[model samples]
Target: MSESSGEKTEQPTQKKLDDARKKGQVAKSQDLVSAALLVGSMGIVFLLTGNFIGGQIVGLTQKSIQQAATFRGELDMATAGDVLLEGLTTLALTLAPLFLVVFILAALVGYIQVGALFSTEALKPDMNRLNPFTAFQQKFFKSRTYIEFAKTILKLVIATGIASYTILGSRHMLPSLARVSPAETSQFILAQIVELGLAVAICFVALGALDFFLQKFLHIQDLKMTKQEVKEEWKEQEGDPHIKAERRALHMELLNEASAQAVRESDVVLVNPTHVAVALRYDRKTMQAPQITAKGADLIAAQIRKVAQEAGVPIKRDVALARALYELEVNSEIPENLYEAIAIVLRWAYTVAETHPRS
Candidate 1:
């Protein structure tokens, strides 16, 4: 069956997964990144508020207000620009650390989830994305859309509950805030806000963890391959079955041709009458022992005998020795076990050649 015809049953291959990742199609939850940033920023603010960040914010606010109050009735362009620049610089300095912390936390969270990935494919404009039908399908028809909607509702409900609980828990301290100094009142309010923010952030992180797993599960489901797709991928890596069979046939044919030439050069052919044949070559000046030049079974054995006969190479029928040599690979030296048998055959062939001196 074709890939389109069958159900996707097999897990995605490593190559497919890698290709998807290259295109920035990874199982990463935006909610996870947001939650991490929110939690990190809230924690930093909670820790640094009174000691560092809070002082900077208060100073900048007071300076801006004082400058605004001191400005003349008709503000010149130069004075206006100076005020704007001073305010912006102070604000930037005050919030720079917070922004930096949030940025690092967001990047770390994204990296933990999807590793280092930068793909322009997602940024590139696509006509399909502009389609109203496609947008409608994504927004309303997909289960993912419903899941996102549910998650949004869940976040709102949890945040509201956390805020209500924080407010109620601090209810008794409300009257005490009015009795305290201005600085004490500001600190108390800041602490309460931080506490509420931390609670909400904790809830978001828990929800994000769950959502991350869900996204991963959905991604795997989407990447699943059909049986036919697996087969096609196998073919792509290992070649088509028919092509492989033809290559094997060609290899065997080449081996047979080389074996026929080896038989012609051999000094002796040991045969199992009709079943097996082994052609051996021996040169006292060159070879250490009798080497099997060619070996085959059945029809190939008959062909070896015919070639040996045409080349005037002697044929000796020895069932045990022939079977043994047949078991050995072509062009290999005779084994120690068959050395005695092969030596005897060589001796006999040499004797025959000496007695019949060919013209």
Candidate 2:
């Protein structure tokens, strides 16, 4: 039976929390590696597609210009629609392979983390999971909901503030750009792109900081354990107290039965007064040495002696040998040191049995 934890289980100490976090933080290395590879491959595909798109756009523009010059007029509207359709078709074609690769990569990541034991049980509809009360408790009572809400609000405020600041900073540029030449316009556009990128980088840093804190919080929360829970788990794993006692009782009963069976068949039942008893048997073809068919103590010892007398099996009084046999041997063979003594006892018993043959 398992030992119980005290009535009040204290929350995990800092040390315990650290240990739990260490155990839980066994990151899936293969999944992460595969994810990196997948992202790199997808990035390459997108880069190639972007180049193709740029070339197609540049080529189309040049062709339109040539057509306009040849016709001695502006390009026809119908041809523009054809150009748009061709660009869209090319975009779709470029994206198809990338999408397929992404889908397979995501599946690989999941497989690496959890293996291929896909359970339809998880997919089956659960009414309890969708219940309003369950949802409310999960969202409010659970710490996860609070953390998610805080992160969402933080992201919104930071992103909006940065975007507003950047837009305000660019107000004068817009009016100036409206009055600029093509060369000046290109310079202004380049400056705007740099400004926008810096603002995005600041927002990204804030997001990363939030992610680190959120993960730490979740790790700590999961490590917290109640005493009652530990005790219950221990009992379930090691066995219930009552169940263990019952099993021990049954085991002793079986041992007694085995002892009785051994006594009836044994050539000799050796006893050390009331404390220990060992029944031994020797069959020339079946065993090279005497085998301890069964052994017992106290009341079981008395039973073994009684059964031996009823079966006409010989009984020998060897206190030291009996104790040694009972202590050393289990359900099998006699000790090697006791072989000479056991052989002498067996020879005497067989001689007596042969002299007084069974009626």
Candidate 3:
């Protein structure tokens, strides 16, 4: 029956959706994350480290050239190592701003998509993933695999075209750069690179947004369940009807036992003569309002009255109040609208207690 999940004739139930979520399955796109990180970090890096990195590179290049010209110890292995180490350190420091911006952008994008979701279910070992047949099917047979392949090709083409167009636009500037100072050349290259990067990043963002919507639709379709699946899930969560019947019967039996004991402790029993009975309990020192300790009609009403009489608990006859109170649940506080009627009953019970106290 699990194989029939592929049919997906009906929309996914909330239970199925929630179960999938618990198992760390959710709609998300790697392309969208990539696009956001590329666009956001590129903009930030261009603003913060663009000039600094270009200047550093130019300075390092001039220093190296001057050192080579004055190379008294350039041939020594130790001296060569020291220069390489210094250049690497300088390069790393210069690129630190870009690395920081990319990291922050990635984290922010992840947060916006999932909002603190941390699941290890996906990381758990899966035998199916290791199987050659399964891998081949997923790679070549699935519709999603072909869609992804097409998207990747489209993106590559777009990026290549954008880069070529940007470079061609700067062809006239390239001839002038050859005759310019090293610092001026570095600045021109930096400007051109930033321009190309921003253009590509914007294009990727648009592609990513389109991919996200497409993926969302696919995810919904993939998760759809059949009518039989929905019915089985409902029974699993709510229990079979026969089982529910037994549960209800047991619950009522327990309530009957508890009500017997409660009627003995109740302050007063309100009765609709022979049809209804309602037991109320209250204490000035502990309770703010009278509480219905038990209520019933017909046979249950007769049993409640019998228990009340045997326990010496007071019985009051007020058909209107009994009928209203009978409608309330056992052990619930009396409503404010019934306070006036309840107070009168309590006063009467107090008088009876004084007149003929229970032993």
Best by TM-score: 1
What's the CA error at residue 94 for candidate 3, in Å? 3.5
- lDDT (Cα, tens digit) per residue for candidate 3, span 98-188: 7887888778766766567778899999999999999999899889988999999999999999999999988987788779998688668
Give the TM-scores of the predictions, in the order they appear.
0.62, 0.40, 0.58
State residue 293's C-alpha deviation in candidate 2, in Å: 40
Preferred candidate (lDDT higher): 2 or 3:
3
List the pairs of residues colliding in candidate 2.
none
Report lDDT (CA) for all predictions: 0.84, 0.65, 0.82
Q: What lDDT score goes with residue 86 in model 2?
A: 70
Candidate rank order under TM-score: 1, 3, 2
**Worst 10-residue stretch by lDDT in candidate 3?**
45-54
Superposed Cα deviation of residue 318, candidate 1 (Å): 42
Global Cα RMSD, each model: 14.4, 16.3, 12.7
Query: What's the lDDT of the predicted structure labeled candidate 1?
Result: 0.84
Q: Which stretches of candidate 1 lie over 4 Å from their true place?
A: 1-5, 65-75, 181-183, 240-359
Error of 3 at 42 (Å): 3.3
